[model samples]
Target: MTALQAATRETFWTIGPVGKAAFYWLAAVAVLAFGYGVYARFAAYARGREDPRDRLSNLPGRVVSATRTVLSNENQFDGDLYAGVMHTFVLWGFLVLLVATTILGIDIDVYRPLAGESFWVGDFYLVYQFAVDAFGLLFVVGVGMAMFRRYRERDGRLWGKHTSLEDDAFVWTLFLLGVGGFVLQAIGIVGQPARADEAVSFVGMAMAAGFEAAGLTTAGAEAIYGVVWWSHSLLAFAFIAWIPYAKPFHMISSFANVVARDETAGARLPNVPADLDHTNAESLDDFTWKELMDGDACTKCGRCTDACPADTVGRNLDPRDVILDLKAYRESVVDDPVAGRRDSGVATDGGVDGSATVSDGGTVPIVADEGGVIASESMESCMSCMACMDACPVDIEHLTSFTRMNRQLVDEGAVDSNLQDVFQDVMTKGNTFGESQSKRGDWADDLEFEVDDARETEVEYLWYVGDYPSFDDRNKKVARSLARLFEEADVEFGILFDDEKNDGNDVRRIGEEFLYLELAGHHVETFADCEFETIVCTDPHSYNTMRNEYPEVDFAEFADDPMMPFDREEPWNADGETDVLHWTQVVEELVDDGRLGLSGNELDYTVTYHDPCHLGRYNDEYEAPRELIRATGADLHEMPRSRSDSFCCGGGGGGLWAEHDEEVKPSEERLREALEDTDAGDGIEKFVVACPMCTTMFEDGRKTGGFEEDVEIVDVAELLIEAMEAGS
Candidate 1:
């Protein structure tokens, strides 16, 4: 009573010797089952190809970063605040409770049994007891939030066709694991031999006091406590065993996926180091082990689908379903990866022998028009905007998996007629519309000064005018305005003129792999002959490819060719990959440096900005355009879906090349949003866009959208130009 510094409990208190033995037996069985399920997943991974990106070069750093990310619950908070708060509480609460349980197990099994000393007592014991009690309540609250979000309030992000009976089971099990633990503790407290130290367990003490107040006599409490204790124990055991089989598999896969995820995944894509032509493979066997595991890692939370531009309107693609289907297929073929590892000729890089049939080992087709796990329609319907990737908490690279399937579709000539025509145009004329290569620089003809041809002269900037801005009349106007801005700023820039091609951005996304290679290779060769420091782009699509994807391409084979056009010793910027900057970025730089001189161009125009998916989400360059907008003295109002959640303009990933069948294309929906957001008491009826594709799609949206008559789509450069003139 005076100095009660030491406090602990028997591991199996009051449970008979036989009951203790039975508990150990159940624990052993649960551990074995959990171990087998986890091992089977790795066994499944062993069947896929090597992922070059899975380098362990910075193992310690990766572990530290992954640990910090997992512990902080940062990824979960990216877009949805409710989910973020809900998940943070659950994650931290569950982790604290888990750690407490582990310490108790270690104290009982290892520390006390082997060392004859306990680290499970005194201040540590009191603190541990308090933490478990507090976090147990927190865990229950989290489970309550999740259950309400899943069933009561029904969050759209937490529901879809992929949501199943197991989802309900996973949540209910977690609920019991938390709430039941507390109930068991309360009943145990009411009946157990009590001491002064027990008061530190505030929740249990309070519940025990309540039980006593309710006349829970020791005899009756003892009778009820045993059942509650055993039920809780069995539930925890089942929870452990079911982790790998149910939604809880995300606990393992999601963390690994996050740690291994490429920071620049959708933008740079995976650069498989083999003959990455994985077309002959029709099943999970074609996907790398990491990619196949991406399916398993998915939480089936439907967040990706919630963020999908394709799904936002009315498209056949559902990213959540795509991953779930892949996960189901992977479970079916878990044996195939294992068999392939045991001398079945599964290549190290996930490529298989062209002659070997994947189906021979139970792996089946993933994408097909008739019978497949992922419908061909879903794959094609994807805009490849990477909105799903940005939205995914687990870092599932949906685009990476979809890109592989799209390549297979291309191999089979499964592309639609509209896309096929564009591919042919890109192949023959080096532009999307089969436009003459000579006209690539026509947009600059009317500029105050001619943009120097990079082939003929050295320049500080090599502008990749891009296909749309160069070919499409509306965007060409934006191109000229940007060119005028560049000239006004005295920026030394040149372009390839006719030598410029489509840059193979959309071509790559459209699944014309070799064609993209061919087009990009042509530019690499031409750049070798030119002299420039940076490749400037007006199209975020082009900027994304050239800045991110192009350097990852293996041009050693192409560049080493004996007779490249305009023969050069090395590819452009051999000293380094040439810096790629979008015009808005460059314009911002110019304005910052006092190059684009202006004073009091304060046109108090309140305009909302449309963030292009590539610029905002893919590159995370949300502010560059916004800064330029403010530079023009416009008050920037953001749409509900701005920045990372920016609605797609329905012009990315070959969407511009194909017909949009939906009654309201994403571009149209986006326009409607812009109009609503900007209608604040006669706010300016113009919306600003930064990318060429955005301009193209939004211009069309302004033509056919519901508020077409009420709004105008202006490029960020055009608005800036308007401001400059206003100052003049």
Candidate 2:
């Protein structure tokens, strides 16, 4: 056979035994560093307090789901398509190369020595070499994309407040390393006899021809090949070692975070333990293990910051910074103990038990308004909208730690005068508006039929008429319209009348923990007096807390008190069951079941619907209200950022009471989004809202922004009533 027909191969340890020995020594160090880095992260987690939520149940399923989520880049794509594409190429290409490297190691170390034959040969060799080059091409392209996007374009989305030289180093090194692999392959072929078989490795073969044309003799090629091989090997090992040290640290942390993520994270925020002393996270030490680890997983892609309504509107809150600051603080205490300070890690029974945490350092406050690692003002600026969590690619529980800091602010009495007033009103008057409890049912006074008190009647739907609907004059009209509409539908629903207090949804979000308990606990007590199958409310805030967070409260404590209106067998939330729902969900179900009849299309105005953060992002109830809108015979022109991606109205988490310096309020920003994003030719004449807070914010926005003539703010109930009247 001629030289052209010979097989193509690179023998193992071509530079001799000394070079091979040196490579092994370096590989050992890199592997050791990587192992220790991983260990330190997990060991440090033993400092945090245990989250009571069982994140490990159905462990296999979680692993599979997380694997799918990462592989598919499911959550990443929806927020920024360009970033998502970049991630996809990087992740898949990297995986392919990683597997190829592992196989090469086995072929050399295990098969050749023991079996006396290289397994990477013949048809298998051809296919394997071709696959490596094919996938390596993708890895090269992805790295180039990353480098150009980060350095050339200086894309603001990739550069958060924590942009560092590490990011630059990471991208440049990875790009060089990726391109270097192909170059090394070309060198391998040119340094040997020409081969027909190597043609299957198309990219490598093509490059080898170029190297031959460049006057590279066999001896010259061999010299260049040794240097290139060592360079690639050292760089590859270095990259692996750097995986847990630099920006690429997300590679490990992100996968672990995703695996441990709770599907109901923000919707059902973690319950504050009754016996815990670190109620206010004075430091990184006060956070739960998972909460503390959340920071280490941040990709800093800026999706959370970009999607943040507060950040978008120029409010002080930056979700990415919040995580990074906390992360930096955690890293600062690495020398204090294996566990930093708090003994909260859930690992027990030989897992990294946090109970064994050695307390060697004093406590430090983390959320000071003036100069803390995480400023209280940023926490206050949070709307509890969950937009950050929704947009996070790694499923970082930003709301969990964000709201915990808010609680600390509340503990320190650092809240602004406006929030302070609302807290006072809730404590003294049993509601935010400070209206008399006797006046709660006054909105239904002019209704065609007397609304049955849940206290005096058994009902299918115990409508929790919230503080705004029960007392605020504007929402009272909506309350009345809903009442009349329910009557028309012949729905079996009743209200608590003067008996109910605020459910403390916003109060809980604002960091008034005990006050929220007082309110939510009292409402649970009030519910014991009534017989109802389901709890429904027009206030999505009330609905959210009751459905998700209320399970944390043990209403059985009140069951023993003599002053309690009724006897109870178990704690109200002991079973973790409460069929809490928003009124739109109920009405939509009614409409589907043919219980609530709607009129034909008489109110066919081009319209847009505003999703309440509580109902849409937190509770996942986007479809019910939209279904109701379609039933109203209106031309439903949904805003571009509608459904799960809907913008907040800025009235939540005490934003209704507090103030900010943004150029436009979140509500006003949302109004502009609806007007500009809706595709109605005649212009959107109506903005329909499902939550009372949304109604208040958008209506105020419409008036304040001089868009009252452009679009009218109306509740879904009012639109239904309009269609109901037309049917009549």
Candidate 1 collision pairs = 49-349, 49-350, 50-348, 50-349
TM-scores for every candidate against the unseen true structure: 0.93, 0.93
Cα deviation in Å at residue 202, candidate 1?
1.8
Q: What lDDT, from 0 to 1, does candidate 2 have?
A: 0.80
lDDT of 1 at 62: 77
Model 1 Cα shift for residue 443 (angstroms): 2.5
Worst 10 residues of 2 by lDDT: 348-357
Q: What's model 1's lDDT at 117?
A: 90
The runs of at least 3 residues in candidate 1 whose Cα sits more than 4 Å from the true structure, single-residue gaps closed, are: 1-3, 114-119, 153-155, 272-281, 335-364, 558-577, 600-602, 678-682
Model 2 RMSD to the real structure?
4.9
Q: Candidate 2 has which clashing residue pairs, if any?
A: 47-342, 48-344, 49-344, 50-344
lDDT measured at residue 384 in model 1 versus the true structure, 0 to 100: 86
How does residue 602 of candidate 1 score in lDDT?
53
Candidate 2 ranges beyond 4 A from true positions = 1-8, 337-364, 555-569, 573-578
Q: Write the per-residue lDDT of candidate 2 for residues 1-728, one digit (tens) a residue.
A: 64333344765526888998898999999999999988877887877878767877899999999999999988768867867778788888889888988898899989889999777766677777778888788778877777777777665778765788888888888788878888887787777665534777788888888988988877887788888999898998898888887788889889989999988887766656544354667656568888977988888788888899999989888888888877765665566553333353422111111112223343234677554666677888999899989989899999888878888888889988889998898777878898888888999988879899889999988999898898888899899988887887788889988778888888887888777766766777788778999998889998888888777665455546454344443556557566888899888887787665665465787888888999988888889988888887898987889888999999988898898878788888888887876787338888889888888887888888878778788999999888877776
Local accuracy by lDDT, each model: 0.78, 0.80
Model 1 poorest ten-residue lDDT run = 347-356
